[model samples]
Target: MKKSIIVSTLILSSSLTFAFDLSAIAKNVVENVTKEQTTTQETSTSNLSDTTVSNGLKEALKTGVNYAVTQLGSNNGYLNNTAVKIPLPDNLAKAETLIRSIGGDKMADNLINSMNTAASKAAPKTAEVFVEAIDKMTLTDAQAILSGGNDAATNYFKANTSDSLKKLITPIIQETMKENQVASYYDTANNLYKSNVKGLVDNSGVMGLAKNFGVDSFIPGSSDESLDEYITTKAIDGLFTMIGQKEAAIRANPLEQTSSILKEVFGK
Candidate 1:
């Protein structure tokens, strides 16, 4: 009876070992499959996310530039905005005051008004320049801009486009002033003011006349060249400033994600 019990115990032990080995094999298979699936899912999600973010940033920047240009193109856009208004600078101010003081006030005011009008009209053209700049921006540039500070994109855009924009805008502004009668106004104010401020000193003494002319540089020259230059410069500055502001707004408070691509990319 004792011999029979020992043999039975040994058979049971062998069966238990086999059952434990089978369970271990099953667990190992499940764990390996789980790990592979997890890795694959993670990689897929990451790729999707990267694609979305890239597309979203590009759309956002384009929208921002468009918005800025639209606002700047409106009436009184440059004239009404003190931050970007094209006012007569120091050299032209003296001439303006001299002319106005001498009963050429209407012409003086007209010149100033025309300068503002020309700037306002030309404001709309800046959008094209900005758009071109956007086209030139690379994928890497877009990525950096996306993660950069609020004005980083604008600054980047400006760095790339300022000289080109200025070149295009200068001629437009000059032409606008000429076509709108501001050119005549500038000429009249400068000529009249020059006589009043410097003409008297021309024969009085060379030293005194030179000094007076230096002081009169702030006035409208007996011509509109200085005023034209001043207005054009100011108009360009205003255009860029508005663009920068719009870019900053986009960076700080982006609009709703309009596309799955945008959502996927910007979700980060």
Candidate 2:
């Protein structure tokens, strides 16, 4: 009887120990599975948020660029729009004013109109340039713009597109300027204004100081290069100006969010 009791006690103890080990193994498995699932969920959420922000940024930029290009590409687009009209260089402002006062107003007007017209003619060609930049934008770039100030999107575009914009737009601007006889008009305005000035530019003493300093180089010219550069710069500036306006409007006014992506993007 004693032997049998001892055997029974050993069997019970072994069974209890086995049961405990099985319980521990089952608990560890359940805990590991739960942890893995939680990690996967967090990673997926992070990836989804980044993708959403990236897509929203691209759509917003495209929307703003298209609208700006369309508006500035239309007839009298730059000439009639005071905000974007191409003016004679600041150096020519005094000359233009004096020229107008002396009845050469039509001469100055023609030059300004021609320059603005050339810009308008070249505006349509840049839509693709901007679109390409937007397409190539990275997720990191989109994140920066999202957290940046009101002009964030515009700043991003300016940094990325300005150089290429100048390159691509220069030839088109040159062609349009030639078609418009911009050089001839520029010459007429320059000559008429110079004759009328006859060194009156020294009245303010700024011109005399420039001459004294041998800095005649400070004066702007009407050479083909100057004309082309000046007009190209103005065109790009005007484009970004329009872009900034649209971006700001979309940020500040819900009505300006024209697309669902834009609404969701800016709404955030």
Candidate 3:
């Protein structure tokens, strides 16, 4: 009976030891898994810190600028694109109608074509301005852009680079306008209106008759801004529009990230 009791006690002790061993093994496995998970998380977080995030943002901007410039600098970029097509200024539309009425439709068409051509020519110069703006992007600026809405980067570029872009692009636009004969066309159209319609409105015997007929109102007198200014402004606006689209695209699709840093930082 005593041997029977001893055997039973030994069996109980062995079962208890086996259960303890199993419990320890399970605890070790859980602890190991948790440590490994924590390590992975910390590594991922370290890779996407402020500096990396800032670099990723800059890379995204650079990629966007390059894409926008390539698309806009090609043949018929501005001329073919209805969205960014340079139309006659509102003040000049009336003049165009009157000129067309007087068998000067070709002249009006020429003016419109020349304006778009100038915008296309000057569009290529915007990349240099964009690069300058990107170079000026601060870490804080990048963080803000990343956290902000889709157009945040685009708005930043506009606010920061508008004045500099104007200075850089205006001369190119002016030169393009001259090369494309925009000024000459404007001058010819202005003279034709003055000769044919100016006298009729002046002698119509009605006060403010010029305004009523929309004749002299369309022709800008001396000291007024030239067509080049309008074209430059519109071209700049179009460039930003394209850049904004690119920015939104990158924000939406992680696959659009071109660089490793971009993938890591934005993939999160």
Candidate that scores best on lDDT:
2
TM-score of 1: 0.59
lDDT of 3: 0.78
In model 2, what lDDT does residue 157 have?
Answer: 84
lDDT of 2 by residue, 1-268 (tens): 9999999999999999999999999999999999998898666545556788789778877878887898899998888877888888766654676577779788778778878888888899999989999999999999898779878888888899999999988998788777666465665656655665545665768777877887665454433346778899999999998877777787778898877877666665
Those runs of model 3 whose alpha carbons end farther than 4 Å from true positions after fitting are 1-47, 95-98, 101-103, 180-182, 185-224
Model 2 vs. true fold: TM:
0.68
lDDT score for candidate 2 against the true structure:
0.80
Instruction: Quote each prediction's TM-score.
Output: 0.59, 0.68, 0.68
After superposition, candidate 2 runs with Cα above 4 Å error? 1-48, 180-182, 185-225
* Candidate 1 Cα outliers beyond 4 Å, as residue runs: 1-51, 94-105, 180-228, 254-268
What tens-digit string does per-residue lDDT give for candidate 3 at 221-248? 4324457677778888888878888887
Question: Per-prediction count of colliding residue pairs?
Answer: 12, 0, 0
